[model samples]
Target: MRKIDAADARLLEAVQQDAHLTAEQLGAACGLSPTAALKRLKRLRADGIIEREAALVSPRALGYAIMAVVMVTLDREDRGVIDRFKQDIRNTPQITSGYYITGDADFILTIVARDMDEYDDFTREFFYDRHPTKTFKTCVVMSAVKTNGALPVHDLAQSAI
Candidate 1:
């Protein structure tokens, strides 16, 4: 892992909150000059400490009403089956996030749809018709108490950063 100072931590924390912030603004927040801040930011990016920046769009605004948590159990646990499932899931856009999980389900997926009908179609197309899966269960999300949050950079290393 690359070593980072307190200034770097502060910079990361600031940037995580707002990626569009100017070098001057970030420097002011992290107790550095604009030039120094930009240099540090560039170094961080080069070292792979800072990943891609993105804008989070509202699903409701885009007319997506339903969000479902799907638990998928595959029939086979072989490498070929797992690999193929991962590739298929990666190609599917409706399944936003998927994890090869432990416990009851082999995979957990976060899916978004316009309504129940659309969701049903997705299940029929992906789960039943295409893949060889044993069982699939879905839990619709009513509301999000807390959706997305910034990573805890400050708490990670007080001494180093």
Candidate 2:
């Protein structure tokens, strides 16, 4: 892992908030010269600390009106089933993210679709007919109270310096 200093931590925090910032802007925010800031940013990207930068588009604006968090309990927890299910999830674009979980559910998925009809189609294709899912429960999002996708840089406080 690349050693990140206080300046790097400050730089990371600023960039996470806004990835579109120019080198000059980043330097000013992080108390570095433009040259130093650019160097660290390149290092961060090369070391894979800063992953892909992408635009966070609004699902509603894109006509994806439904967001569902689904807790899925599989019929079997065997290695083959788990592997296959993970692959299936990877191929399914509607499933934005999935976590292998503990407790009542084997996996939890964050899904988005155009509407209830599209959501139903997804369930029919992935859950009801073909998949090994035993029971799945969904909670449709009424309103997103918080959607900060940025990871916390404060956790690196001790190590960063």
Across 87-159, the per-residue lDDT of candidate 1 in tens digits comes to 9989998988899999999999999999999999999989888888899999999997766557777765456
My TM-score estimates for the predictions, one after another, are 0.91, 0.91
- RMSD to true structure for each model, in Å: 1.7, 1.8
Worst 10 residues of 1 by lDDT: 152-161
**What lDDT would candidate 2 get against the real structure?**
0.88
- Candidate 1 residue 114 C-alpha distance from true site, Å: 0.5
CA lDDT of each prediction against the hidden true structure: 0.88, 0.88
Q: TM-score of the candidate numbered 1?
A: 0.91
* Model 2 lDDT per residue over 1-161, tens place: 66677788888898888999998999997788999999989999999999878787788998989999999999999999999899988998898889998998999999999999999999988997878889999999998887757887755754533
